[model samples]
Target chain A: MERERICFTLNNSPVEIHCHPGERLVDVLREQLDLTGTKEGCGQGECGACTVLLDGRAVNSCLVLIGQVAERSVLTIEGLAAGGKLDPLQTAFVTEGAVQCGYCTPGMIISAKALLMEKQNPTEAEIKEAIAGNLCRCTGYIKIIKAVQTAASARLEG
Target chain B: MQDQVVGSSPVKVDAKDKATGATKYPGDLRVPGMLYGKLLYSPSAHAKIIGIGLADAWQVPGVRAVLTANDVPGHNGHGVIIPHQPVMARDLVRSVNDVLVAVAAETMAAAEEALRKVKIELVELPAVFDATAAMAEGAPLVHPEGNILSHHKIRRGDMAEGWARAAAVVENTYRTQMVDHAFLQTEAALAEIDDGGILVLHVATQYPHWDRKELSRALGMPEDMIRVVGGSVGGAFGGREDMSLQVQAALLAMHTGRPVKIVCTREESFHAHSKRHAMVMHYRTGATGEGRLTAVEATIIGDTGAYASWGTNVLRKAAVHATGPYIVPNVKVDAYAVYTNNPFAGAMRGFGAAQPAVAYEGQMDEVARVLGLHPFAVRWQNAMTEGCITATGQVLESGVGLRATMEKAGSLVGWDVSKING
Candidate 1:
């Protein structure tokens, strides 16, 4: 197995790291770049805990190999906030009590962010569909859905 | 005594860290000179171990050490109530998930690869998969003490007289399948010898103090020599209450004199951890024409699987709560925790009350139908009130709210307007 040097924009910063082609993008980000915010719930893509935005699209980093993300811009939960300010979705989640055990919070927020990016005001069904991949075992999806709706409404008002 | 913070929604202290991914779970931990550990589970469900060849595994590159049942310095068994389960299968493999070998190496891949080189010879034995079949006359014994792990019974008044006084009787059998906790994070543990020569294990578990005591017993070390620290658990719906990889990682770290980390894959988590006991319950209830409960008899059999984890306690709970919250003068309840070759059964959210609730509630509905009375009305008539004596001989001096709760539910659901039969 040979290690390949790859360059990519991580959390809006250009970085280069050597990784095995067989390694998963989630492993590369966590082990190599020290971006441990992205969790690997299920190594299989069934769980969306390892969700990261690649080229403005939400993707399961566990399913994506290191070679697949070769020069793409990746955005993780760590990158959602900037200048010591919480993202609207993060703030809404905190206020709405959507972060129960908090294991699924990062993935849920990332999915909600992608949804908000695509549509300013998504319907409840659309919001549910967007985050259907992420599973939160603690709080039954009601609180999470409410949090996303709150963030969407806040975005519309602001 | 409603305080400001009692009913108010306050943010969790760790919510920010967990949401920001700053909270480190056991799997995310790493130490300098750390070695990855992997275990080789038995392939056979029930078998006798003929021999295990570890020469090829020892020759694997980057393999630090290999351990089997022989390597356990002290007690080989660990269980919550009964210490019968082996840390590693000593002579016979009772279940498919029984661990046989553990390997430590530089990388997880190398450790897994080394596990592949280890060969184990097994002689297959007849396996019992059902609790009733396992308890029958000459079935295969899962344990030397026989298939019945623990049997609990509660006898109050005369069941025969109570049934004779009733006008209608309802009997049914209900069953529930085994359930996994399915917590977000799987089992993981990291162990290292600290500067003070104490083995410190950071693990995802429900009980850190219990893990320390069990680890001390398993490794034959003083309680002070072992320090168990529970990290921010991803989720533990009672599955993490039992020991999984805690002692194994500690043993490997002690053997190699380096930090050892072990994380269970989802499949491994399902195969290895304790699950909710599957229950088969038979219930027969006698009700008068007025819909008042006369007597109830329940026989519950819980499949505790390969080893008794919390079977004894669970069976007792099932027996005690078999009658639900109803006031029955003549009640007979028998609960048995039976062993089989299935996955080990232990604590879950409901403990053992969920299965019996289903049976008793279903019987209540049947009794209501037979007497041509509304379900809520029948339940309200028989619901325990203040000063009512329970089948276990406990008098309810206060907090008898079953009838009130049922009436409130009926009103909230518009039970009077809705079709009651459906």
Candidate 2:
């Protein structure tokens, strides 16, 4: 119930907020910093809709409290694009028709970003296993998988 | 043939915003002086409302308004087709998800705490859950009307002659359970009285016109006075076809003179919307030794649950498609939808037509096994042609492509029809 000043690096920018330490990172990002790209599908952490990068590692923002995010680097869907250009994963999703309703797009792209960061050439099964935490009802995950493959191939051929 | 988009996939207009998370869903949007709204649901499945003590809820510091069924400004009920569902349980609670009271507070915590302060008394009643049993004599009435919500039947050709020509008869019973759509995002809505005193609603829904119509009924306002706007929905798949908290949020906003938003948690979302209907189907399909021409009889019972959302239309389609895409000279189908104390069932992927494939198609496989004929051979023999008449007595005059599709599927699956059937 106590409110205090919380500091963290958000989207490559240093930010500070005065809020309860136990508040969820997803809530803090959306309500405090106005980073609404971090979605909250299931608050219980079962769904990866609130996925964000914590020090370059994908984590569900809903599960991490503001206290855990203190002094840590976080990246959200809004930050995935740089210099007004969409990330390759996002572009691949658009071209592959991987989006429907799009609630899971942010988390899917974030997880894919984390995967491609770790391995430039991940196998198809590894790509599926990487995004296994993120659930998508539409697209049946076929388009999403294809989008990831397309993005990886584009990176390889670029 | 001269079209640019017919043979190619085009980028969706909303895809960029959706991927970037720039698209604001109902929950993401906020206005000045907005309050969080929460509703108190029934604990018992069926009960008689004794009293609603709301004084304690109003005593909360930030709680602006605590409303019960009696506080509704206009009509108290809302439903997709029938206006029989009580927005807030007035005299009776029909299901476990029935709303008893609503609270509006500056913060979600305050609203939740205010919800705990409201007191409701109820007398639990007998309940029915099974469709077939609910139709029996002396069953507890879920509604004032009888348990049977709708009955659809199909009868064509002579059963005696068709049965006499059959060499193999397959009879079996199949049942499907209630299935949830489980879209990634739950239900959320925001309602506010705009500058012009018109209520502007932002919601995740499949149909905004229906929302406007139902809101008009619940708020006692003219249709023109309401403006419904669609939000960035996660997924609907028929789940957003009915009202969740559209009326409750509007009423709270109307009373508090501020914007009101209600977001249903995953638990509440499961109970809020109608799911795919659970069906019990019985089919008696007969075919000759050559896997051609006979009679098909089917009886399907669908449990519509607490309210009839789209049960009538669903069961009708079930009966119409009970025989599947095959041609049977004589056909008989009796499909019934019934009311029960369970959660309501409505539109999903198939409405009611998808479940019967287990029965008729199962019968097809059984005939194939009994006659030692290839599965494709049996289906190919009974495939409906252009002039075939459906069980509902509708004749397909043109563009009936069942035979053509079967040929394509057969070749794709390496089914050689020349050596198997002929």
Candidate 3:
């Protein structure tokens, strides 16, 4: 395999790495960059556990090749919080008791961040629609929906 | 301090870590000079292994070590309750998930390449698929000990007495399908020698102490020699209660003298771990004209697959709970865990109790239909109260809140709990 160097802005910071063109972004993030926030529940991309924002749009990091992300800014769970302060969505998830096994939290928060970036005050149906791809076996999705709504309301108040 | 926390909602200890992606699951762990491990599984559910060729796999440049059944230094199997499941199948392969070979290499790519190079020869054998069919006299034996892994029964009161007092009866059979835990994080583990030269195993498992016992038995090492660090588990339900990637990774780590990490793909995760028992339950529930349950007789046949992972505990629990939360005077429950050539069933969300609910509850609905009583009314009538004895002879002494729950549910849906006097 031909080794290629890819450059991308991560969490508003520019970063570069040398990897194979077809290597999964999830692997590059976890194994190479040492950013373990993006979880890989299903490598097939069916499960949204490895979701990350590719230019502010949530995409399955496991499906996106490292080379495909060249010159684009990517956002992960680690990048959501700013200036050592907890993001509203992260605070909401913690307070709402939405993080159960915590394996799906990173992806869940990233997906929510992508939605709130576009829509400030998303309806419950809109929140549900955004997180439809993300599956949480715990909490029955009730507390999760509530958390998303709570975060959206926080954004509206701010 | 303990008393203060008892009645209050305590924030989960790991919730913050989980929300921030700070917890490191076994798959996310990284150590310098770590090798990746890969496993080769049997192609057929039931087969006789003719040969396993490791020559070509060992020839791979980045390959560290390729191990087969013969390389296992101690006992080959790794089951917790019954050590019948072979970590590496030698002569017989009872299930398709059975591991035939394990390879350790510098890169996961190399490990995958090595696994592709290793060849296995097998002759397919006749396999029984279900629990009931496997119990027949002429059925192919999944194990030499016979197809019945375990049989649990709760014989309470006389069957004649139970059948005689019945005003209305419901008899029907219920079948439950096999279910996977589908935990967000697939099975992953890293095995390496610490500074003290002891094996330290990092894994996402429900029970680390149990892992110690089984790993000791399989590795032929003392329990102290093995150290298991609990990785931040994503979601187990009941899937991580058994050994999956612990043994093979440890073996490779010990042999190659390197930190060996093995992370299963989604497909491999489905195969490597145990599943929930797919049960076949036949229920005959009898009740009086006033909706008081007289008796409940059930025969539960759980398809435990190839080996008895947690079959004994599962079937016994199923037998104990066959009558549900109702009060029945006379009850008989016979639950069997039978061996089949499908995926081995271990622990799940409900163990084995969930399957019988489909039957007993259906029977309750049918009994209510025949007696022309409201279903909730019938449930309220037969609900287990304080001081009531269970079918398994356990007396409900205190905190028997079945009726209290029904009262709240009754109010929620506008059911008149006080007005329903049968």
Candidate 4:
């Protein structure tokens, strides 16, 4: 089996790697690239655990093959913060107790970021729609909804 | 008095890593000189292993080793409360998901290809799929010990005398679905024998200590020789408690003398992992004319499936909570755990109480409707307080939040008596 040479920018860093054509982008990033910040909840895209912004749009990294991402820019949970400051959504999640087991937090934060990037003031129903795919069993969704509202308000003020 | 951490909600310790994707799940782990393993599952539900032809699979270029029951070298089984399940089927395959052969290869694709090439000869047997039929006379026993796993009864007071004094009676049956944990992460493990020949398992499990004990016993190895590490779990919801892909991975690793990675696919995850018991419960309750409870009785039957993982405990929990949040003076409960050929049912979130809660709550609603009383009023009147005794004969020594929960839920749902009148 020959390892294919692939080059891509990850979290603002440039990297070149040799991988099989069929290797999942999630695996290449985690195993070869050592960018473990993007999770693979369900190998299938049913759960949004591996959501990463590909060219500024949220996509399931598990479903994307490494060969498909050649020369493309990928942003993951590790790239959410610019410099040393925590992203407002991350701070809001921590303060509002939105994270329970935190298995769904990274994806939730990414999904919320996608929503806030497009709309500064999303309604409650819109917020629910944004995170409907990322399921959290512990918090019963009350606090997560509140966290999204808090982040939306903070974004509005800024 | 200090409040315990159990009641107060705090951020889980693993929350940060999980949130930042920094937590290393078993699937994410990579070991030095590690090999990928894939098991050849029996397609037949019940069968006898005539023979296994491993030549073609071994011929695969990257295949490292092929293991069957002969390779176990140990007890050859693992069971939670009973030793009924074989790690790999010896001569008889009891379930459709039984692993007859295991293969390890350098790449996952090579391992999967090798798995497809492994040949198995099986003779089919009559199997039982339902609990009631399995309990009947002369049903094909799934286990050598027969279909009946465990039966528990809680008889507190005289049911005949209490029912005779009642003004109204309500009898109902309820059913709960077989819900899966569907934890974001599937079952995965990385097993390797260290330089000292010690097999250390890095697994995604809720019970790390228990896995060590069980793995040691099943592998017929010293407990000290095994170190079980709990990796970043996607979520358990009670699914990861049973031995899913652990024992096989460890055995293959130990045999090949290289690290082994066995990660279950989603479909395999659903079939191998334990699911919440699909239960059928019968409830009979008698109350006074004023909607006050007099006595309650219940019969709960649980399908233990293949092994006694946590079915007996689940049955007891269902019986204890059969009366729900109500205050009943006389209670008689009988809970039965029966075996069937269905997928193994064991612990899930809410334990076994969720099944009875729905049933008992429905029964309470029936009682209220019969007495022409408001449902909330009937519930509030009979709700268990802090000093109340549970159906299990255990006193609530601390906080009993049924009434408060009921009131708050009623207020939130707009359960106004005024609305009922109109």
- The candidate maximizing lDDT is 3
What tens-digit string does per-residue lDDT give for candidate 2 at B95-212?
Answer: 8768899999999999999999888889989989899999999998999889999999899999998899999888889999999888888889999999999999999999999999
True contacts kept of 1: 0.53
Q: Which sections of candidate 1 miss by over 4 Å?
A: B1-3, B417-422
lDDT against the true structure, per candidate, is: 0.88, 0.89, 0.90, 0.83
Fnat of every candidate, listed in order: 0.53, 0.74, 0.73, 0.49
| Candidate 3 regions with alpha-carbon error over 4 angstroms | B1-3, B420-422
TM-score of 4: 0.92
- The alpha-carbon deviation from the true structure for residue B210 of candidate 4, after best TM-score superposition, in angstroms, is 1.5
**Candidate number 3, chain A TM-score:** 0.97
Model 4 regions lying over 4 Å from their true place? A1-5, A20-22, A83-85, A137-140, B1-13, B416-422
Q: Which ten residues in a row have the lowest lDDT in candidate 1 chain B?
A: B413-422
Tell me the deviation in Å of residue B85 in model 3. Answer: 1.2
B2-110 per-residue lDDT for model 3 (tens digits): 6786677666788888888888999999899999999988889999999998899999989998998887878888786888788789999999779999999999999
Whole-structure CA lDDT of model 2: 0.89
Steric clash count of candidate 1: 0
Of the two candidates 3 and 4, the one with more favorable lDDT, higher being better, is: 3
Scored against the true structure, residue B196 in model 2 reaches a CA lDDT of: 98
lDDT of 1 at B289: 95
- In candidate 4, position B345 carries an lDDT of 88
lDDT of 2 by residue, A1-158 (tens): 89998888988899888999999889888887888778888788787999999999999999999999889899999998986699999999998989998999999999999999999989989999999999897855999999999999999998
Error of 4 at B318 (Å): 0.8
